[model samples]
Target: MFVKISHLYAENFPQLTAPFRPIWGPKASILLVDDKLAAQLNLSPDEILAALQSDDVAEKTVAMLYAGHQFGQFNPRMGDGRAALLGEVSGQNGMMFDLHLKGSGATPYARGGDGKAGLGPVLREFLMARAMAALDVPTTGSLAVIETGEQIWRDVPQPGPVPGAILVRSAASHLRVGHVQYIATMGDDALLSRFIEYVLNRHNMRADAHENMALSLLQNVMERQAALIAKWMSIGFVHGVMNTDNMTLSGETIDYGPCAFLDEYNPASVFSSIDRRGRYAYGQQPAIGGWNLARLAEAMLSIIDDNVETAIEKAQSVLSGYTALYDAAWRDLFAQKIGLFEVHKDDGDLIKELLTLLAKHRVDFTQFFAELGPIFLGEKKRDADNFAAGHFGMDLAVWYEWKNAWQSRRDLESMDEIRILDVMRRANPLRIARNHHVEAAINAYIYKGDDGPFKALYAALSNPFEQREEWDIFDAPPQMNSPPFQSFCGT
Candidate 1:
C-alpha cells in the first residue's frame, strides 16, 4: 500500500525552486532508476525516466535544518548542506521511510562548498547501502544515481563522471537531534520546543509523557545503535564517519560514504583518507556513538525536562545505557559468528580467545570466520583422508590449533557435528564488499561499461552467508596485486 506525504511548512522557509514544483531543482543528469522503488511510488520505471529527463518534481522535498560538531569543533551552522528531504512513504512491513536526494544543491548550511558529490562517493554509497540491506542491516536505501554530465573539482579536477551526483535515498525520518540543536542555537526557545514536540510526536510518542522526552528518545536511539554497531563489527563492516549530523534519530545507517570492511586484522585500520586521526575508527565507534548522543542531549536541554538540571541528569542516566547495550549486543552477535547456539557466560571468554588468536595470526576477519566450516569438519574426522575430503588440510596446522579448545569442551560425538558445520556456514558470510572488488566494479563501469563483474559481486554479497553456485572468485579475497584498499572522504 502507498502512504502519502503532505506538504512541508512553507511559511518558515523560502522555496528555492520554481513555485510550481518545489521538489524540482538543478539536477543535471538522470541515469539508472531502481524499478522496485519506482513501482512503490505508484510510478513506473519509464515514468521515472521521463521525470528525470524533464524538469518535473520527482520527489516531494521537506528541507530540514540542523547543526553539529565537525571534528570536535562545534559548527552551529551545519545543516543538510547539499541534500534535501524528498519526503516519506510506508514500505514493506509497515515501516514509513523517507526518500531524500543527496547532492541536490546548497542549502542554509552549504558551508562554502558547491553542494555536489563525486561519482566515486555516489557509487560507493549505492553499493554499500545495498550490501548492508542484504546483510540485514537497518540502512538508508539507494533509489537512483544521476550523473550531472559535469566534472567536479575535488582533490583535483575530474568529471563527477555524471553531471554532479544526484542520488534519491530512503530513510526512516530526517528529524535529527542536530536539527533540534540548530534551532536551539538560534536562541528561540519556542522554536526549540516546537522542534522537540515535532520529533517526539513523529518518532517517540511513548517517551512523550516523560518530562525528558528528548532524553527518552536518545535512550531509544542508543539501544538500536548499539545493536547496529555490534552487527557491523561482527560482519567486518566499518563506517568511516560517525558524525553527529550523519547519525539519524530514527536509528538507521544514514551515510555510507568512505566505508569499507577489513580484509586483514588491524583493529586500528582506517580506510577513509579523510579519517587521518581515526576519529571514527573500528574500536572508537561506540565512543563516537556516545559522544554523538551526548550532542543530541545537549540540543534538547532547552525543553527536555521541567528545568535544565533534571534533564541533564536524565540524559546522563540514559547515556550509560550505551556500554551495557553495546556489550550485550556485541557478545550475542559474536556468539553467532562463533556458531554457538546456547551461549553460556563462558561464551564471552571463548569469543575473546578466538579474537586474540585471530589477532596473533593476522587472519583476515571475513575469510577466517568463513573457514570455520571446513576447519570444524576437519577436526571431527576419523582419519587424515576424511580431513582431505574438504581440502581442510590446506592450512591444517593453524586450523587444528584454532579448534583445539572446541575439542576440549564440546561433545563432537554426542552432538551432530554436521549441525555445527551448518551453523558455521550460515554464521559467516561467503561474500563481502572487499575494497578491491568495489574498485573493480568502479573501474569496470568507467572503462568498459561492463556490468558483469559488478553483477557477480552483487549476486555474491546479496546472499552473503549463503553458498552460491558461482562462488569461485567471491569465496576468496583478491590476490596480492590488489592488496589493500583506501577510500577517501569525497570532501
Candidate 2:
C-alpha cells in the first residue's frame, strides 16, 4: 500500500525550496530498513522503494535553500546540496516528520562538487542517529539506507573510491536556524514573518498574552537547545561539527559527521580531524550552543521588536537566560549519574571534583559511572580494583576518599540505597557506541561487505541501559597507547 506523503512545506512555502528529482544510480537497492520506524509510519520497505521509483513522490521532492555561518564565516548561499526533502509523513504519535533523502545527487546548491554520499558516511549517520534516539536524545531519525550501485571518490580518511549510498532521514521539520537567517538577510521581511509564523504553528509555540511571537520563538528555541546540549554532555557525545546550518530550529541533533563518544574523561577531548583548533570539543559544546542561538537571535531581531534598540535588548534578555538553563540542566543530569537524586546548590562542586579526578587519572568516562550501580548495590565489590583497570598510576586511597565523600553527600540528603542505585542505573548507560567499535563496524561493512558486526553493534546500542551478557564487549573502551581516533566530515 502507498502511504501518502504530505507536501506541507513545499505547498506552503514554494519560494523557499526548489523542486527537484532524485538522480538515483542504476540497480539501486535497499541496504537497510528501519523496521520499527517503518511500522510506526505504517510503511514497508517495498512501499518506500516503490514511492521513490514512482513519479509522484519524486515530483514532490525539493532541495531547501538557506544560508549559514560555516565555522564563524558566513556562507551566503548554502542548502540541501546533496539531499532532497521527499515529503512528510504522519506517525502514530500524530507528529509530522519530514522524509529527506541524502546522497540523492546534485541540485542548485551542489556548488561544483558531485552531490553524492559515500556508503561509509551514510551508514555512519544511520548508526549514530539511531543510537542517539535509543539513548533518549532528541535527533533526526534514519528511515532507510539504499545502495546507489555507484562509487564515491574521496581522499581524506583513506585514498580510494568507496561505494555510494542514500539515507532516508526523518525529522520533525528540516527548518534550521539558517532558514530564518536566509529571508532576514535578504531583506525579505514579509517572507521572514510568514516563515516564522509557519514554524510557530508547526511547533505549537503560539505567543501568549505576555510575549511577542518572535521573542517567544527565540526564547523557546534557546530553551530547547539548552536542554539538548545538556543531554549530549550527560552521555559524552561530541557532535564534532557545530555549524549554524547544522543547528536545527527544531533543536534536534543533525549532521553526524565526525561525531564520537568519549573514551577518556578529558573535558578537552576532540575526535573530529578537521577540528584541529578544538572549536567544538566535548566541553565547549554548551558555549557553542549558546553562540549558535545568538546567531538565530540576530537573524530574527527585526521581527522580535519594531525598534532596533528594543529588539536587541529583548533578544539579549532571552540569550542571557540560556546559560542558567543549561547550567541547571547539566547539574541535574550529572547529579542523577552520581546517584544524587536531590540536587543541591553545592552539588556542582561534587560533580566537578569527580570529573577532575577522572580526568587526572585518564579514566574511562562511561565505565566509571556505569560500574557504580552494581558497586553501590553490593553486587560488585566497591574496592579500588573495580576502577583500577581503566586508569593508571592512581592512588588507590584517592578512590576510597572520593567514594567516602560521595557517600557522605548521599547520606546528608537521606537518599535510599536501592533508589539511588536505580537512579544511577537509569542515568548511566551500560554500553555506548564506542569509537573503535563504530570504526571497526564501518570498516567491516565497507571492505568485506559484512553487516553482521554492524547489526550486532546497533542491537547492543539500542538497549544501552539494560544488562546483557552478549553485549559485554561493547562496555570496553579503546585500549591505551593505541593511535588517537580521528573522524572525517565525509563530505
Candidate 3:
C-alpha cells in the first residue's frame, strides 16, 4: 500500500506543494504512522504513510517567521531553525493541531550550524510529549521517529552518529511568545498586527492585545502562562530550559530537551546540563514563566496601544493576574492529586507540606506518590532499608507525617473507594517518561536499531492511567551509579 503522505495536506500551506526532495541537509529519514491516532483523527493510515515518505505534500502552512531573545540575549533572529510546520491535524479529542517535522533541516533561520537532530533528542521529545499528555498537561505529541540513513557529527561520536535522525512531530501550533517577540523586534508592525490577529482568531484571542479592546492581551497571556507553569510544578516536572524561544504562546509544552521529572524532590533541582544556575529549576519555573510573559508584554506593547506609557501601564496591570492564576491552578491540581475535591481557602498550605515531605524524603516524585495508591498512602511495611540503606533522607518520617494528614483528610470512605483510586492512579500515572528508562530505550533503539524497548515504552505510556503491574519500572525514577548520562545540545 503506497500511501502518499502528500495527500494528508488539507489545501493549506502552499509551500508544502513545492517540489521537494529527500530532505538532504544531513538528516533525511521517512516517517510512518501507527493505527491508533490515525483512526481517532479520521486520518487514513494511507495518509500517515504518505506523510512519512513523500517529501511533497500540498499544504498552505503560513510558515511563520520571527526572532527571539536567546539566553537573555536578544538574538533578534530566532525562528524555526531546525523545524517545519507540516500542517494541523486532529488528535486525542478532536483537537486540530500542528503536525511538524523536527530535524527536518535548516530554514532561513538556520544561523550556520548543522541544523540537524539526533535519534536521542528525537526519542526524548516523543517520550516526554506523550508522558505529558498522559499527565494531563497540554503538550506536543511524538508522532514518529526514523533513522535518516546518514551520518551527523556534533562533538563526540555517539550511537547512530553515523546515521542522522528524522522525526515526525505533532503540536497544537508552533507559535510562541518568542514568535511575537521576533516580529516586534523586526519593527514589522504590519506583520505583528497580522500575527496578533492570527493568534486571536486561531486560538482564543485575548481582548488585551486589541487596539481598543478592553481586557489586555498581555494580561490574558499572563494568566495563561501562570496557569501553565503551575501545572508543570504540580507534577514536579522541570522544563530545564525555559528560554523565550521554547515558550509557545499557544500554551503547549514544546521542546523536551534536557527536561526531567523530579526523582528526588528539590525546589532547586536542575537536570538540564545547560541550566548551571538553576534559573529554570523546579521552583523557579512559575516565576520565570511570569518573567518571560513580561518580555512578551514588551513585544505586544505597540500592538496593545500606540501610546507607550498607556500600553506599559496596561501590560503591567495584566501581569498581576500571574500569581492568582498560578495559585488557583496549582491548588486545584494538587488538591485533586490528594483526593481533595474542594479547595479550602488554606488548602495551599497542605499542598506545600506534601512537597516538603517529598523533598525531605528524597522520594521519587512519581513512584512515591504512586506507591501511595496501593495502600492509598496508607501504612506500608518498610522499616528502614529502602530509605536508610541509602540516603533516602528521613523520607520515612516525612511519609509518616504525610500519611497522618492524608488519612485524616479521607472523609469519604463511604463514597466509592474505587473512584478515588482511579482518580489518584490517573493522576499518578502508572508510567511516567522516566529519565533513565527513556534514555535506555533511545540508546537501544537508535544505537542498535532495536525497537523493542522503544515500542514497550510507547505502549506503557499509552495507558499511563491503566494499572499494569508489568510496566511498573516505567513509573519509578532510576537510581544513580547506574550509568553517567548527559544530553547533547540538539542544535
Most lDDT-accurate candidate: 2
lDDT of each: 0.68, 0.86, 0.67
- Descending-lDDT candidate ranking: 2, 1, 3
Each prediction's RMSD over C-alphas, in Å, is 4.4, 1.5, 4.2
Report the lDDT of model 1 for residue 371.
Answer: 67
RMSD of model 3, in Å? Answer: 4.2
Task: Return the TM-score for candidate 2, rounded to 2 decimals.
Answer: 0.97
User: 127-149 in candidate 2: lDDT tens per residue?
Assistant: 99888988899999888999989
* Runs off by more than 4 Å, candidate 1: 1-5, 8-30, 35-43, 49-62, 156-163, 208-211, 377-402, 407-420, 469-471, 480-483
TM-score head-to-head 1 vs 2, winner: 2
lDDT tens digits, residues 1-491, model 3?
43223223324323222322225444444444445545655566555635544435423332345566566777766666676666666555755666666676666556775567876677777677777877778776677666676667666324334456766666666778877777677686776766666666556656556344323456556666777787888777888888888888678887888788777678988877777777887899888888898888888788677899998888777787777888898888877777677556657887788777667766667666566555543344353345333444544565666567766766644445567766676666555677778878877986688978888887897777776777876776676545533554566
Worst-scoring 10-residue span by lDDT in model 2: 384-393
How does model 3 score by TM-score? Answer: 0.85
lDDT value, residue 2 of candidate 2: 86
- Clash count, predicted structure 3: 22
Per-candidate TM-scores read: 0.85, 0.97, 0.85
Candidates, ranked, TM-score = 2, 3, 1
Candidate with top TM-score is: 2
Which residue pairs clash within candidate 1?
Answer: 147-162, 147-163, 148-162, 148-163, 148-164, 149-162, 149-163, 150-163, 151-159
